[model samples]
Target: MSRVEARPIAEILAEVANAVPDEVIGVEFERARRRGAEVWVYQLKIIAKDGRLLKVEVDAATDRLLVAEED
Candidate 1:
């Protein structure tokens, strides 16, 4: 099997930090399958300056924002 190349975590985190106006408190790596293709994603837990918890997911291979929700 061939390995897929993913973007650097620092780069991804930098982008996320720029886009979101919150502080990233935690991060999780997740593997999922989509349309028969294996995909890698980064799940982030963020704490808003005002104390709200947020969850964000970004595609590792494409650097695409998959999900962002408040919890």
Candidate 2:
């Protein structure tokens, strides 16, 4: 069987920095269903400078931002 390797963490963090520009509080790797297929994701918990908590998800394979919202 073949496997999809996730992108490097440094690259993922850089991508997140560009998208969020906030202090990341936590990070986790998760397997989720997207378009009915399983995909790997990086779930980030962040704190905005304005004091709002945020949640962000990035696709591990493509370095794409899947979701970002204030929590």
Candidates' TM-scores?
Answer: 0.83, 0.87
lDDT of 1 at 63: 83
Q: Compose the digit string of candidate 1's lDDT tens values, residues 1-71.
A: 97655788898999997899789989888897766877899999999998999999898988899888997
Q: Which residue runs does candidate 1 get wrong by more than 4 Å?
A: 1-4
Across residues 1-71, which tens digit of lDDT does each residue of candidate 2 receive? 87665887789998888877889999899898888988999998999999999998888999888888887
Q: lDDT of each prediction vs. the true structure?
A: 0.87, 0.87
Model 2, residue 38: displacement in angstroms?
Answer: 0.2
The 10-residue segment of model 2 with minimum total lDDT is 1-10
Candidate 2 ranges with C-alpha deviation above 4 Å: 1-3
The RMSD of every model to the true structure, in order and in angstroms, is: 2.5, 2.0
What local lDDT score does residue 19 receive in model 1, on the 0 to 100 scale?
92
